[model samples]
Every structure is written in structure tokens, then in C-alpha cells.
Target: MSADRVVQLRWEPRHVADDGRVELSYPGISVVSSRQGEVVDRKWVPVGEEPTFADDEALIAVLHAAWRWTRPAA
Candidate 1:
């Protein structure tokens, strides 16, 4: 069987605002993934409005799903 994969969002302590907005940092919001306890992918999230995602890439997909619970409907 293939190793179980996991996706995680990591950021610095003060880099994220109380409103869930991320400030400009060297490595903005980090989209990290690992399989079998080993890191396999890492990417920076593009700057955008809080609680909304425009990218459909695999990494960004996770963020989209998570934001659904936090943001109100338009």
C-alpha cells in the first residue's frame, strides 16, 4: 500500500493576523505535505483575501476546504 499522505498549513506566530490574514513574509503561508512521516512537497501560498482561495492546485485545494468552515457565505 502507498504511504498515507498529509497536508498541513504552517506559519510564523506573528505573521498571521487575528482576522486570519497572512502578512507578507519571506515564505508566506506554507503549504506542506508529507507521506510516511517524510516531507514530500512544500509551497508558498499566494497573497489573497482572507478566507478565499482562487487557485485550484492540489495544495490550494486543502485551504479552500478548510476556509469553508471559517468564512461566511457571500
Candidate 2:
């Protein structure tokens, strides 16, 4: 059996800028999106570990998951 890894995402509202793009920040990760909600850039704190940018599909999946996770229960 394989265990699933849970990613804890923490968004910092203070870091948000006037730009159309939205910035989501976690412990050591940051995801930036375009005004239309397309991911434009991604970065890791301290740098130099993995690729800075993520695949479009992967980024979308993560954003969707995060939205669902934060949505209020009906």
C-alpha cells in the first residue's frame, strides 16, 4: 500500500500586490499567476533544489485542490 503525501499550503494575503496576478505562498514555496489566473511563475525559498516553474496542468491541479480544501462546507 502506498501512502499519500499531504501538502500544507499557507497563503499570505499581505504579500499580495496590485498586479493582476495572484501570489500564493506556503512555508517555502511561492506560486504566481497571471491576471487571468494562469500560473506565470513559481519559486522555492533558498532556491537551487528543483525546477522553478511547474507544468501548467500540475499547477492547475494544485490550485484546484487548494481551492477545494479552503472552500466552506455546504
Best-fitting candidate, scored by lDDT: 1
Which residue pairs does candidate 1 place in steric collision? none
Q: Give stretches of model 2 more than 4 Å off.
A: 1-54
Cα RMSD, each candidate: 11.9, 13.8
- Give a tens-digit lDDT track for model 2, residues 4-50: 22234444333444465867433333444332344434433322236
Error of 2 at 54 (Å): 8.2
Q: What global local distance difference test value does model 2 have?
A: 0.42
lDDT of 1 at 20: 68
Candidate 2 lowest-lDDT run of ten? 1-10
Report the Cα lDDT for candidate 1. 0.55
Candidate 1 residue lDDT tens string, 1-74: 23355667887332445556755333346766666677767666554444344544644666665444234354
Question: What shift in Å separates residue 57 of candidate 1 from its native position after superposition?
Answer: 9.2
TM-scores, all candidates, are 0.41, 0.29
Q: How many residue pairs clash per model?
A: 0, 0
